[model samples]
Target chain A: MNTWNVAKLVAAKDLRIEARSRVITNQVLPFAAIAMVMFAFALDNENDALLVQVAPGLIWLATLFSLLILVQRSFAIETADGAIDALRVAGIDPGGIFLGKAAALAAQLVALETILIGAAVLLYHTEIRLGGVVLLVTTVLAATCGLAFVGTLYGGLAAGIKGRETLLPLLLLPVVAPVLIGATRALEAAFGTGKAVLADGWPWLGLLITFAAAFGVVGVLAFGPLLDE
Target chain B: METIVDLRDVVAVLGQFPALAGASLTVLRGEIVLLQGPNGAGKTSLLRVCAGLLPVVRGHAVVLGHDLTVDRSGVRAKVGLLGHTNGLYPELSVRDNVQFWGTTVGASSGEIDAALDRLGLSLRLADVQVGRLSAGQKRRTALACLVARRAVLWLLDEPHAGLDAEGRDELDAVLRQAAASGATVLVASHELERAGALAHRTVQVIAGQVHEVEQ
Candidate 1:
């Protein structure tokens, strides 16, 4: 089997496994809803440039947080049933497993981002046009890839440590700050532009793309040593 | 037949403590090798290093002509390892668990079912979430991986940990069948007499070194 099938099978199995948990939806839906509610209260129906300046970042941040909570695919079940060793023994590459996990997390992130955007429109009076929509989608995809890519790597590292849940964010936040910063800025620029121009935006966009690529590659190589340990 | 596992002065130190300080052993194709030791005699550690799970601190283990230190993934492909953990998914039903893992290792559906049958895991249990499985059944589930994907080297760490008499019997049967198929089997066991039944030879691990048993 090629790398693509390895990734696909891993992702498919994870989704099917997660789908069995009726509580997963219940757990994720609230995170999306509340983030939107927080936006209304914090923004107070204001579209001031400062708030709008940061809106994309704020929304992306919320989505990332929600993904962090919802991305329990790598953490929760493995601790309980010892399912991860099956993957280790099955000859699946740790990096491929990371991609499988990231793909699954992205699906959840997309669903949550949709809710957040909807909430932004109804609650915060956020203006979103066709260009804005395309940029929003691109930003979230890149941002989520950054988050999932980094999150799954630390997830493995912290799996064996004490206070892992708490330890993970601390370890990951610093590594992912660049992506968060870059994604937030790109989204703001995406909203501010008149011609959907990307003169100033590419730097941040490039940072995000670079972050995802670097994190994905390192994750693939390092995960094997960590998994075998 | 080529020796599936050949270790040369392999020493594994975990977190400042050396588990296998200067251990060496050779396991050939079609043999069941038992590693008997006290609770912390490095039996599992030695087996893991041999299976490419643990890195060698001092020396190297060469399995199937692949160095465990250099070609760990290659060693992994040719070996089936049951870590100290059972590694089952609590949310997935038993059948999904087996099939998910079966496909991951490139096992055909029929092969998975047949392996499950050999382990005495009922088809009905396939749909039941692993959270509901009894400890014995969980061990059975972990052992079901024995037939996962035709791995030549079966590295079982404490395979009988939670098994009942019947489960141990099932494991013995699998070991015999796997050896018959020319698969090299290495089991780390605390159960002395029972493990002796599974392997024609026993290597006692004492203070990170392995030596053959003498009459």
Candidate 2:
């Protein structure tokens, strides 16, 4: 088994575990859906117009929280059976473990984003052009890549620490601020809400891509040390 | 014989505390060295050091001919550690848990099945989730991983802690078999009587230092 092969195996194991447990499918997705509904109700005073106007931000917010939960669950499972130690001693490349985790997180976040996007479309009565749809999907993928990389990096850092569940967000949220801003701005431009920044949308997309590529590489390199005890 | 583990005044700190406070010991290939110690005596830490899970903060330590201070990760591929925890995924079936570990180390399917069979995990039990198994069964599944791994150095911490009489016998047989195959086994256990019967030699730990015990 090579590095990528091992990573795929690890990710497949996680996906299988999730498929059996349905912890994310059953719990996290509903939590995201309900939270998005709450956002709609909270801003009900502004009616559908206001809700649709801010749909991009609301969707991104929901995805961010969902990503947090997903990352926590991913690492928590590794600790359940001393899986972390197992990974360390198994002799597989540590980078494989990191990439495996990040890949799994990205897959789950993409699944969650699909559901959240559907909910956003239905509840917010949002209208998106064909071009806007392309931009939205691209933005989600880039942002998810960056988020998954950072989340996996921070997840390993926070594992086994006191109050790690609480500590993870503190470590993660600040670093992902750019992802949120870039993703939302790109989405906004896609929706024609960023009238003056329409031409600038490409730059925002570039930011998302850069963040993804940078963190993806760093996470692969840094995961080995972070995972080591 | 080549030395599988050699440590000279090794100091390994866990948090603010020194788990292996100037600990030192050596084991040649194919020897079953029993590690006996009381609680907080650093037996577990010593095994971790040998398995390359812990870096020696000071002094000299080498495992499987790989220096602990240099490239600990290099030793990991050939070393298998079965700690107090079963380290098998609770959600995964006995088969899946064993398969995961076996596949990680590039073991063949035939080897995996042979290990499971050797550990007496029946076809029925093989599909059962680890959480559903008794503690003894979980330990067996964990042992199956070590068998499948066929590692050079086996570091077992409390290998007999949760086993029944039959499980203990099975584990002893496994340890003996591993040793006969030229694998070095370092076991940390409080069960001195059983461990003594299985080990070629016994080394007790006290306050993070290793001392030889006369058989």
| Residue range B40-153, candidate 1, lDDT tens digits | 899988877876767876676798788777766676667777767778887777777777767777889888888788788866776688889888788787777657567788
Cα RMSD of all models vs. native, in order, equals: 3.0, 1.4
- Tell how far residue A218 is off in model 1, in angstroms: 3.3
Residue B46 in candidate 2, Cα distance off native in Å? 0.5
Off by more than 4 A, model 2: A194-200
What TM-score does each prediction get for chain A alone?
A: 0.87, 0.95
- lDDT per residue for candidate 2 within A102-182, as digits (tens), equals 898899999998888789889987667676777778888999899989999899999978899899989999999999999
Give one digit per residue, the lDDT tens place, for model 1 in A186-212.
776666633335445667777887888
Q: Which stretches of candidate 1 lie over 4 Å from their true place?
A: A22-24, A42-54, A71-73, A189-206
Docking class of 1: medium
Model 1, CA-based lDDT: 0.75
Q: In every candidate, what fraction of the native interface contacts is reproduced? A: 0.65, 0.75
**For model 1, what is the error of residue A43's alpha carbon versus the real structure, in angstroms, after optimal superposition?**
4.9
True contacts kept of 2: 0.75
